[model samples]
Target: MALPITDHIVAAVSKMVDDSQVEGYREPSHSDIEFYVSRAGLTDADPKAQGQTVGKAKRVRAILSWAIDNDQTAGGKLVESLIAKVRASGGFRDSSANFIGADVIARAVEAFDSEGYILSSDGALRPKNLESLMGRELTVALRDYARRAQKGSEDAALLSGTSKDLLEATAAHVIRTKYGSYPQQANFPALLGQAFIALEMATPEDPPSSTESPYRVMERGMYQSAVGVNRLRNKEGSGHGRPWVASLGVVEAEAAIELAGVIAGYMLDKLDNR
Candidate 1:
């Protein structure tokens, strides 16, 4: 069976196929004969069975010699050279979209829809189908790109390379600048845990970064909100309530966590505070 990679195919591909476009196919096309020998290669003809057709030309070099011997234009002859170029190899053989005698190849390319594979508002060949693919295969390419980018974000979120030791550190910076310290507690792990959650909750397009648990715009913005905030939350209440203060005791940063106090006022008893 004919495969995409073959010496003859390579030779034929070399003659007309734009070397830059074909990725990694190179062959010597010195004259008309070389061109013919190479052009004959584009078909699915078997090297052994088709040997009789281009007879005794065994290799691409031998085929070129034969073309020079019998044909004046070498073996470059084809029913429609341009259309043939598109069938055997994608891309335009010549500057013109028209192929010999018919526009079969060009028309087929133009037939595709924009998203499905249009002729391209600019006259570039778009891969309409996976019949032939060079370079990166587009079959699962877009999806793979998404996965790779997502994986990168997850890694960055895990890094914890920030100044603040709390979730949404970036937001904390802004909020701290305005409100002294963010309402977030100075706890390390709890804030970091929230940061991780923030990063995970982030859309694939944008992720949260920082030391604190990125719960909102802070999570969606920069800063998981704090360092180890996520770990602190997970260590205790699955990641729900007040920021855990990782210290000798609990000390609020610049501002007090009135919410924690509020909950304490409601669910948490005064004895529990002790």
Candidate 2:
């Protein structure tokens, strides 16, 4: 069977980055597709690829694309971390000569996410239907490494997939501008010179944000045990940073980013009225 959708995205991104290099481009370190590979499968190469020097990173992206097409509920960094572990293990052992590399296992994880949680008792990054967008991105990022590897090479196949995706995205955007009603935000992340500084707990030593925002308690406490007063401190303590949150595509955690935005907006409206 083909891989999932998240994997496909990874493949496309990887290709894009790979092809970019041929244009005498120097992509940023974080932008390098390889940074995402360990999560989207495609760890080691097969006997043919191993010796023949096929791009392992490209293969990883290919596998990742397969996963994305098949799965959407998956997302976030936690799951990415798990896929990373599997890739580090040198792929999985199979009964037949056809070894199930990180790519194959990643596909399985998508299925597991689609079905429900697929973790072992040890809580390792096994299958789980509790899809998280964070996990999905994590997968895409890893799978893309393969494309990066290809772009690094002089092969025609390098970045072939990525070029197609960019063209598609551009075309789609044009069409949307001409026909669509709901317009996209001109600035996607923070606009202009805005920067996002990260803050978090200091582990066993520091404990500042344990009760900062009573509002967060109402927001994250659902589908979770950490609610009420506990959420407040952390909310304010993070120096007003966007608090770390989880996704729900993993069949667990219940947070619609858009919905959250809507609610916040409504509250803001009410405050203004008052």
Candidate 3:
């Protein structure tokens, strides 16, 4: 399914595209438009020949619309680029020549926030959808782990630990939702199995039969991956107080984080759908 693009984002981009009538508005040059179009990898027609305000707005809308329908990631990147440009320009001025940069920024920020992203101070975008899917507390912990893991001194152990926490939190959320509370003393695999059981979905223990559906096969694989994430955390993660550091690099750590995110998202999605 195609991911959503908010109306506010489209409006904000349209405003930036043709704000010449505004009192202190600085119109983007032809080169500027071309640059943006090129950066977004849009290849419909010449942006310059797209005509005046109305025509330009239509072109922008069409590009964004097509992007969302065809490739949602590209669509998201395009929106991110537009928002960054608007922020960089400090926004356009109103008819009274009042600086309304803050208002524009607020609208853009709010739009992204609703979509589960944090536009950081340095303009870097980070996903925070877990907050909405799981809860704010779990999301907060995940974000902290992400931030620490991505620091200049990247800690593989910490990243590994975060991956485990990601699944733990997800499983805990599922079990708690179904049974009022999860077993605190349960091990990682047990907790994860309980989550799948609570959701009435297949777990790692569910053996593949000749007549098993493809979905069950996929579910079994996913459960195994969750267990693997836990195993990695136990061996290389920070909580063990290991005497020697594991021979894991940033790339491995990043992969672990990404894997954890995908699994967690899948689990949470199942929870929501069920």
Candidate 4:
């Protein structure tokens, strides 16, 4: 299948840095695109090569895919992060009129807020999705979470709560897909724990060890994250009138979100052929 956001990322990445706060910010050019694409391994030819052969769509897809899988890719930061940078830098302008600058990027992210795709953690270009691997009900719930907990929002508790809930919904969907039954009435962590068992990811009594498979390690981490998320949900999450007593932040909530996504993606992939 064609990769997400490839059609628009190049345009988004083409603008000059508009950080009014910082002097000497450089505007991006076709040269920057060429360099980034080549460095991302999306193109074999040097940036100084002849007429361009790799289309922007192809380059964007490859760069985003590399960024998702590798941590050190160039400028693969989340679109939101880029937006924040632009906003901090006083925002960029584009003569293209159809630009992908800060204002446009913000709108794009907001437009996709209730959809299946989201900006990844680093403010990179990939449009992340859970709907393809999950059901409509689960994805809708996740979309709600994504909208509320979006970056730059001050609702950290809501972010943690929504992420925890998203993890639960993912488990429910995966369990149904794997075992042909929906788990009803179970708490979030319990439902996830049972899903892990059904997948043979780990046993209930097992402790972390050096010998476990990577899948097992992932399951262990997901379960532990759920525990912390649930605790944060009760203590600091929305829907509670209690005074805030915890230290939940965007970073922690974002970590839970990323972890939930990784676990869900692994589980869904395992069920792909079955």
Candidate 5:
């Protein structure tokens, strides 16, 4: 099945190309078209001759359409790369036409924003669907942290800190849903345990005998993983005056974030069922 490449995204790219022609700005060259097509892992299905500018735009559209029809993940990546390229080039503006680029970027941002994603300050595309599962305040906070954590150039300290904050906000949201508020005085692991208990999931606090069930064991393991995440956060994460740990890297930070997300999602699932 074709992936859901929204019309808004497709139109944004096509419009940018078309608009670039008005100002006589450089359009994507033949090699550029070939590169993008190959990048998306798509074969050019439309080869009809047309005006230079319009032809390039049409070829881009054709390539993107073919990508959507054939490859799900690559299609999204292709769109993201195109948007990033335009954004990096400061929009589709000529030397005398500053507004063009801004206009194109705004349209692209709006298109992606509508699809539960955000264009970060550096123009990186990141997921922003926490609103469906959390309050606006928490969702915004988590989204910001997640974006920073996921950025290609983020430092290990920031990634570690943001990953920890993501879990903390998630736990707070789950706890707030069950009770009226979260315990501000609780430690990270304790707060995580409270969130699990609030959702009636197995926490480390559960008796050893009761944790023997496979599901319970898995939940307990999740709780332990969260604790480990907290430990990493304390040792290497930001928000402290501690010295930077050279050993912590992107891979470890990403793993921590993914683990936190998994545990948070599991707890939220329980909260939803309740």
Candidate 6:
């Protein structure tokens, strides 16, 4: 169940939009507004309802959703702030309209463009999905990773040392925390391999009688992928100096960084559960 969105929530959100002062900030389109209202149970519950109606709660949720989705920088900040407040007040409910607070929604403002899944508020990283995978223990590390990845995603020139360095560092940190120690001088790829193996062992799975278990097989494949990422990082990443002519393109940088984030997130999450 979801917490009540309430008339007060609507008024508060309206104030935020008004205060933003972002030029040409879009208000919710009629269709979007209708959809939100209908989703919030503000419509007639009749199966054969002829017309749609909206209450303050539904209207507010729709507008906030539009703002958070479209004008991320300004709108997302406002939404995050509101969510923080509501959560502090112990107000969370079950329904999409009622579930106004989401970490990914707040974090999406830090992304470069809206095109990529690198910081999308949707897909595997929706707020509830993350909460299920992560607890308070891993919040700080996850947040740090998000901040670093945000910088890497934003840097089109790929010279800020944000992408690859952060990815590698994050993997090392997760490995160290999970295993209680990491090889003093192990490279990023090695650390990543060690981390995945540790996570696999931590989970209780059926022992294979002859052939390797699915867990071993999966981790092996992931280890190979990590090595490839490390190679990419070495050649065109934020590591040691290369020839002046060697340049890191945005695509390569993002792919490496995103892969690092995925690997780190998955391992850390598994460790937390174990």
lDDT of 2 by residue, 1-274 (tens): 1123344335423432232223333222222233443343433322223444334345445444444454333322313443443334333344322223344455554444554433221113322221232223323322232232223211111112232111112222222323442123433121100111011111122223667665444333321221221122222332233222322142221222222223323222322333
List model 3 lDDT by residue over 125-244, tens digit each: 445443334454554444444443335223322323233366677788788777777798899889999988887778767776899788887888778887876666644434446412
TM-score top scorer: 5
lDDT of each: 0.31, 0.30, 0.58, 0.48, 0.60, 0.43
* Global Cα lDDT for candidate 5: 0.60
Could you tell which candidate, 3 or 4, scores higher by lDDT? 3
lDDT ranking, high to low: 5, 3, 4, 6, 1, 2
lDDT of 2 at 253: 18
Candidate No. with top lDDT: 5
For residues 1-274, write the lDDT of model 4, one tens digit per residue.
1233332443443332222333443433345555545554544333235444554434444455445445333434333344444334334334433234556556455544433345432233223333344454354444444443343232322322232344565677768766777658887767877777766667445787788677777667667766665555544344344212356565765665555455555655554534
List per-candidate RMSD values in Å.
22.6, 20.5, 13.2, 11.2, 11.9, 12.7
Better model by TM-score: candidate 1 vs candidate 2: 2
What's the count of clashing pairs in each model shown? 43, 58, 0, 11, 0, 5
Q: For residues 142-177, could you state the per-residue lDDT of candidate 6 as single tens digits?
A: 654544454444322122323334345445556667
Off by over 4 Å in 2: 1-3, 6-11, 20-22, 28-35, 45-61, 65-274
Better of 3 and 6 by lDDT: 3
Reference-based lDDT, residue 137, model 1: 40
- The better-scoring model by lDDT among 3 and 5 is 5
lDDT of 2 at 127: 24
Clashes of 5: 0
Q: Candidate 1 clash total?
A: 43
Quote each prediction's TM-score.
Answer: 0.20, 0.22, 0.44, 0.41, 0.46, 0.40
